[model samples]
Each structure stands twice: as structure tokens, then as C-alpha cells.
Target: MTAPNRPNAPRWLPLGAAPTTQRRVFCFPHAGASAAVYAPWRGIAGDRLAICPVQPPGRAERFREKAFTSVDALVDELVADIGDQFTGDYAFFGHSMGALVAFEVTRKLRAIGAQPPKHLFVSGRAAPQLPDTRKQLRALPTPQLIAELKVLGGMPDAVINEPELLELFVPLFRADLTVNEAYAHRAEDPLPIPLTAFGGHGDPRADDDELKAWGELTADRFALHTYPGGHFYLEKKAGELIDIFAAELAG
Candidate 1:
């Protein structure tokens, strides 16, 4: 596979997946995460659903491109870029900050009168209208920002131990932080698609209560699922996560 040319340009790396069935599930990464995070889901997601992981810039092969600093701009590009993947039935699954981005993308699709998703799976995030617990990290000093990343989970010890590696992540993390901090959720009509909210049972940022509130964002079916672990619980329970997603999309 060819490496990505830029940080902001999406790495449309397919997981060697062939959607043998009807529904296809598109996956989005969390803050500072790349499409490769969902690579583990490819085999188990079943042939019925194509688990295409959306790669945001500034990580993985996209290391050279400038990461998106604004949420609106990122969504705009993604909505336009994902046009080719809209075939057959489709759904969206996003984790942490990606959840909000997926929701916003859904809104943009709706506004443009595009085909809506069959289902929306939002994991590790609060409802759009909920209060933001964490403050913006872009304004923090570099050291402080790294500390915040530690608290968020998912950073490897090797990266922290190596100054060169950590330096590579600083800009990407900052851009992701800026995207999250600057996002403003304007009130809009509820979506017609069903929503399945997933979260870590022990995630400090969002609990079952906060996740359940995501039900209010949609007019269709709503369900909240909890897995064992912290903010990055999906990594620990990847098999179970794929199982849940497959079942939802199959239905």
C-alpha cells in the first residue's frame, strides 16, 4: 500500500474488505487516532458489512499532511471525499471525538439531502447538547498537553519514552484538540436514523448516563451499550465491539 502524502488528506485504506452482504459500516477514529486503529475489526465484522476505517490526517501514513484544525473544515472535506463509499446500505461508527465528527457529518449529509445512514454507532462520547467537561487543550503548554494525552488513554509507553516520537505527535494532537474545542453544536432537527451509543463502563469522560443522553439526538431507535474498560475500551473488547456492530448492521 502507498503511504499517505499529507496529514489532513484522508488515507482511504480499505481493510481488504468485500461487502458480500447489504450493509456497510464506515468507522472513524478518535482524537489523535488513525484509521489503523480499527484494522482489527476487519476479519470479524462479517462479509456482510465492509468495515472501512476513515483515516484523518497527521497520523499513520498521513503523517506528512497538515492535520485539520477546524471541525467544520474537516467534515466538509470528509463528506466530499466519502462520496465513493456511499454505495449499498451504510452506517457510521465513531469513537471519542470521532463520534461528534460523525454526527456532524451526518448533519451535513442531511442538509445536502444526501442518503442517510442506516444506523449511527457513537462510542466514548457524550450527547451533542451535553456540557463539555474537559477544557480546550490547544492553549496549554506542550508539556501540559502531553499530560492531557496521558489522561485520555491509548498513548503507548514507547512513544512517551522517545522524545523524537513524542515530538511527531505534538502537532497532530494539538490539531485534534483544536477541532474538538472549537466545535459548536447548533440545534437542529433530529435525525431519522437509529442510534447505538457505546461507551466504556469506567470511562471518566463519559458514563452510562452521559452516553444514554445520545438518544435525544435522533428520532429513530436508540440504545446504549457499555463495555469493560476506560476511555479506550473498544481496544480491549474489539471482538465484542465488532460483534455488536455486525449484529446492528445485519438487522
Candidate 2:
């Protein structure tokens, strides 16, 4: 697996493709995060699930580029880059902001008559149709945005306090917030594939009720699982989460 930080290369980094295997899993990271977030899951997933982490700009190797301010633009770039890799049976797992990206991408792929993922694992996000009261975070002052980040428990305290790091990350945060806030769910037909939503039991962002709303978007099958933690539940329960993922793939 390539480290999240490389000298000067593309931001997205994928890991663990068996030379002979046909299946692959595309993984997307949360807002203000890099592809390295899924590095630890590579060993747990083994060869059955070849993990490909999608890295957005303004982070990791794409740090110098301007971050995408719209979800549509980002997904377009993603499809252009990874469209050919959609030949085999594939699945998608996305967390927080990534979950939003995955859902939008699925819709885009379906519109173009491309192969959709076999399964989609959405973590730490509420269905787009649900009410999102935190939309104002996009307009919050710098200090307030940093404070909100601290409460989300994803960014390290040191990074949040560092002026240089904050300057680098704040724009990305705003871009994510814009993507989330500007998202509008048109009254379209439901997806034809199974949808799985996972979230922390105590996650204020996405509660059980909100997560279950994903069922309305998929006609095939829907499952919602809750773990014990705040926003970043996967951090504490990665082992059990991997087992759940393995079982899902096996089934």
C-alpha cells in the first residue's frame, strides 16, 4: 500500500489488487481525510476485497490543487479516472462526506448505463433527503469551524491548533460543507441494488431513524447496523466491522 503522503503524484491511492482476482472494492474517505485512512483495513480485508481508496484534492498528494466545491464536479472527475476499472463485480464503502459522494456516484453511473456496485456500505451519514441542521457550518468563522471539527473527533487537536494546518484544511472543510449543504435529492426512482448503512449508536449526525431512511432509496435490500462510539465509530470497532464486511461479501 502506498503511503498517503507521496512526493508529487495523484491524490488517490489504491491498495491490494491480486494479479488474478476479478473483484474489487472502491473505498472513499471522509471529509478532510486522505486515502491512508483505509490502510489498516487492507490486511483485514485480505485478497477477497481489493481496497481502492479515492483521494480528493487539497489533501495528500493533491494538496496543491484547489479542492472541489461541488459534488457533481468531483464525481465527474472520479468517473473519468476510474470508469474502466468497473468491469468486474465491485462494491463501494464510504464514510461521512464520502458516503454522500458514493451515493451520488452510484446515481451517475446508473444514469450512464454503467455497472453499479454489488453493495454499498454507507457509514456515518444521514440520507440526503433527511433534514440537515448543520448546514450553516459552511459559513461559520474560522475558529468556529475548527471548534466544530474538534467536536467531530476526526481531526487531531494539534492539527486543529496549528495555524498553517488550519489554513490548509479550512478550505477543504468549507468545500465539503458546500457539497453537503448544496446537495438536493430529486424525486427519482429508487436504486436497484442493496444498500447498507452503518453508524455509531450515539452519532448525532446520523441516528438510527435517519440511517434507516436509506431504505427508501433502494428497492433491493436495506440493512442498518449500529456500533458503539461517536462520529468516528470505525476507529474503535474496525475488527468487528471487518468481520461484518467479510460476512456481507461472503453472502
Candidate 3:
């Protein structure tokens, strides 16, 4: 295989390097999350798979950039930005809104005849075909939005309580939610890639049935795993989750 072109990388931050290994795992974070969210995975992934976390706009170091408000636009920009990084064997792992972004990015890569990931791990999200039944929260007022975030338990209490911090977070959250809510699934033949669907058993946002529906999105193998927590289950199960990813990607 031809080597991927080496250029100034964009939108990707390498957590650690496993130079001996040929495969990489690109992780996309949930809504309002930054690349730091995957810091723990750096150790658990061992020395065989590099953990590269995606840094979306308007978060962390990219706070000066505008966050994407549409999935299509985000995918297009990511594909162009990443360029030749797809030449080698790689996998994608995404959680919540990140799952949708990863899925769509995979599709876009395939659409353009670019290389596809060896595996796709989607967590804390319903299958794309399933209609999102959750009430639209993107348009909710500031206090109401903060309340929803509190219920989701993704944001830290310190961040939630700080008005100055919330001023930065609320817009980023709104932009991400807009992207999530505005996404419209387009019908196509199932992807040939293997898929693993993961969720929280008690996640009100995504249930077992919705996760199982991911099987229909892939033409190859499909598996589902649920942990004992709510929507942000991976936060508590990161080690176990990394074990599963290491095993599957090693295969």
C-alpha cells in the first residue's frame, strides 16, 4: 500500500504513539467534549494502537474557531483536512454525537473511494436509521439547556456552576446539538465494515433496541455490548471498553 501523504495534520491530536504498530484508532468525543476526554485511553490502548483524539472546533485549543453547525459540513471539512492519513489500517470509535459524526465520515470516505476503517465502534447512540425521539434541546433557553446538561452528567459540577465558564460552553454545546439535531440520514447500501455497538443499559437516550439496529448498517459482522451505567457509561468503564477495542483492533 502507498504511504499516506505526510503533511501538517489538522483536527487530530495524538495522545500517544505505538510506532511498531501499523494500525491506529481515531476517537471522536461526545457533544461539548474536547480531545482531553480520551486521555485515559492512552494508557489502556497498550502499545499496539495509537489513540488519536479529534479536536472539533470551538473547544479547548480550537476555542477561537467556529464550531460546525451541520454534520455534512463537518464531515466534508474533516475529510479534506485529514487528507492522506487514511492510507494505513485504522479504526474509528465515537460516542454519542461523535458516533454519528464518525459514521457519516466513514460513509463520506467510502463515497469518495477513500480507504475505510477496519472496524467502527459506535457508543451511546441509536442507529442512524432510527428516528431521534428525544425532544430538541438545541433551542432551549440557557437555564433549561444547563439543566439538561446537568441531567446528562457529562459536564463537571465546577464547570456547570461557573458562569464565566458556562458562557464559553453553552455556545459550543448549542452548536454541537444543532449539528446532531439537523442531521438527516440518507439511505444507502450497508457498509461492508464490521461494526460494534455499545451503550449504557440505563441510558435514557439510547436503549438496547436502538443500538441493535446498528447491525442493519453493516454488511459484515455486528456486535452489541452494554455496560452498567447511564448515557456516559464509558466514563466509568473506560478500561473494559479499551480492552474490547484492543482485542478487536488487534484481530
- Cα TM-score per model: 0.90, 0.90, 0.94
Task: Give the alpha-carbon lDDT of every model.
Answer: 0.79, 0.79, 0.85
- Model 3: residues with Cα > 4 Å off, grouped in runs: 1-10, 14-21
TM-score of 3: 0.94
> Where is model 2 more than 4 Å wrong at Cα?
1-11, 14-20
Model 2 — TM-score against the truth? 0.90
Candidate 2 or 1, higher TM-score: 2
Candidate that scores best on lDDT: 3
- Poorest 10 consecutive residues by lDDT, candidate 2: 1-10
TM-score of 1: 0.90
Error of 1 at 12 (Å): 3.1
Give the higher-TM-score candidate: 2 or 3: 3
lDDT string, candidate 2, 1-251, tens digits: 22223332234554433221345567888888888888888777776666677787778777888888788998888777656555456778899889999998898899999988888889998998787776468889998888877878989788876899888888888888788778877767999988899899888788888899988999898988888887899997877766666667667
List the candidate numbers ranked by lDDT, top first.
Answer: 3, 1, 2
Compose the digit string of candidate 1's lDDT tens values, residues 57-108. 7788778889998888988887676554554578889998899888888888
What order do candidates take by TM-score, descending? 3, 2, 1
Which pairs of residues collide in candidate 2? none
Error of 3 at 21 (Å): 5.1
